[model samples]
Target: MDSTSGPLSGIVVADLSRVLAGPYGTMLLADMGATVIKIESRQGDDTRAWMPPVLDGKSTYYMSINRNKRSVALDFNDPEDLETARRIIGRADVVVENFKPGSLAKYNLDYATIAATQPEVVYASITGFGTAGGGALPGYDLMVQAISGLMDLTGSPETEGFRSGVAIFDVITGLHTTIGILAALREREHTGRGQLVETNLLSSAQSGLVNQTAGYLLSGSVPERMGNEHPSIYPYEPFPTAQGPLIIAVGNDGQFRRLCNVLGIPGIAADERFCTPPLRSRNRTELRPILVDALSTNDAQSWFDLLTEQNVPAAPINSIAQGIDYAESIGLDPVVRVGPAGEMPGIRHPIGFSRTPARYDLLPPDLDADREHILNWLGAESRLAAQSRA
Candidate 1:
């Protein structure tokens, strides 16, 4: 009857954050069978109303990340609500919030308050910036992308700076928050106490930049916008095919040789201009025409099958829907059904274990879907005035 037995099964996460990053972090925990109770304000999460392409007059953004968790709506400023909120935090194993640095202090819901009240709670704080530095800045995914130079690197090599289509910084920050919370949980077993964990969009973006950050710091040179043309790799960007663009990654000389062979143009590998990775990189212009000559012959999938057969890593670029379908076909079960609402499709937890499988819990709750259940469990309704938020 219970399929939920992941490593985090016993953990209960109090999620006081809204929008993508915080909700995304809680979703990750939810995917792993953690009991995540998501708190909302009296007005509900800002994104709950962010719907134009609504499914049955509900926000898709709310559906996207809030699945597999319980939603509790309360006004943090209300004294009774605050007490109830504090009680939840006091019993929680972890708490995730994305409010501004000191915004929660007035309501006595900040990390300090929680840690002081519940020493064993792993309090996770997610923000646009760190609590200390740049804390006052508005935390938004696009703002972080713009400030962190990711936008500058997007789009073509010409016009203006552009944001990534998705909220990459938010997603990455959420991941970092997840990691921090997990790490603190692991360490709590040793010290028998909790700790404060913090992550933000700016830091996550900078950390994610990897070599891009190192290059600027080491070389005193700002990398210009290169579109999809990779900085160090040659002939690796998407190339034209009969159907559409076929992305190829001839990362090394060996891969280049194999790719050339797959194109039925092994002679190209012998050409001095394309003989070595460095040489090919330097002569991408000369090599581009020849590579395109062979690539343009077939569609992306045809070339994808051929290239894989030749032991070269290649894949046809897939849209979101196609990727999901492919993952499901291979038994990954990428989508899961969570409740409080009905069963809605969502991406399963990325990691799996043979011994400790994650719980396939119900869908994300409608506002206070858990209110009656939670109140009944706590026996608070007899002594407390409460109602469902949905």
Candidate 2:
């Protein structure tokens, strides 16, 4: 157990989630010091089998988000186990699940069933689409990306559009779910009643599309794939340097001046055709050759250092390793060692609280790792309730 205190120190989360979206959300809550009980089936979360990146024979995919939580395995088909599952939810302050709509009702673990007994339960449900017309659709990140127009907005116009390197929508949906759950919990403080919070990958993808979605909705303009180019910003994509590509995000005219100065071509910043942001974007065809010519004099690393020192908003394209190294060099310790013995290395929690900080006390568990402990705790609670009634 984590000895550190946090804002959610006393909250208990009954986590019936699996895979990325649901589990990822619960992990955030767990990091914030919730007593997150991860309940898995006999085979465990599907991601546990997504291998080739296993550490100590465990799937790194599964390990990525399951830290700081206790694990319990239960079969709802068994009457005793089903009763125990219900009891755990009954005592929980929050429940996170990603089961298909109507599926959990049979197990008597649906929001309605649990809320009937535990009125203040904050029940969070995650889905692929939603509970309505898309109810039957399978909730996978790639499928949602395709159907939600994310794929159409990714990649270059000349190439077949590609899915993001990671399951972005799933992660986004999980974050949305986390926000919804927290909001519902706060609302429960006033109303004395719990509410159902729901998020789906498709809905999250549409919301995450942000400017692209708004462009289509407000202007009747369909946004298409622009590859690495930004539709509204000039020099926002990577440019070839002497040795490699460097990303230069010139957000405004001021940054443009700074960039031109760094390139030893300050005159380009004053040219009327490329002076302002909109002009630069409009006359990118004219501006690109000039910037590329200037940049070709220096390798990407040299330009990165020179431009960054001048606050020109630039960086050389770095791989995942280099990105982490860069973060570390700047004192953003992005990794943490979890578990009682610090046995596993996990990403550091993103948010920082001055007082009630996030905690990482447990490693990712083996299946049913906390079964005996959880069952004993439930048994103790049952006896207490019996005595109170008597």
Predicted structure 1: lDDT: 0.82
Per-model TM-score on C-alpha atoms: 0.92, 0.98
lDDT of 2 by residue, 101-168 (tens): 99999998998988888899999999998999999888999998899898888899998879999999
Candidate 1 residue-pair clash tally: 6
- Relative to the true structure, candidate 2 reaches a TM of 0.98
Query: Which one wins on TM-score?
Result: 2
Best by lDDT: 2
* Per-candidate clashes, comma-separated: 6, 0
Candidate 1 matches the true fold with a TM-score of 0.92
Deviation in Å, model 1, residue 106 alpha carbon: 1.2
Give the clashing pairs for model 2. none
The all-Cα superposition gives candidate 2 an RMSD in Å to the true structure of: 1.2
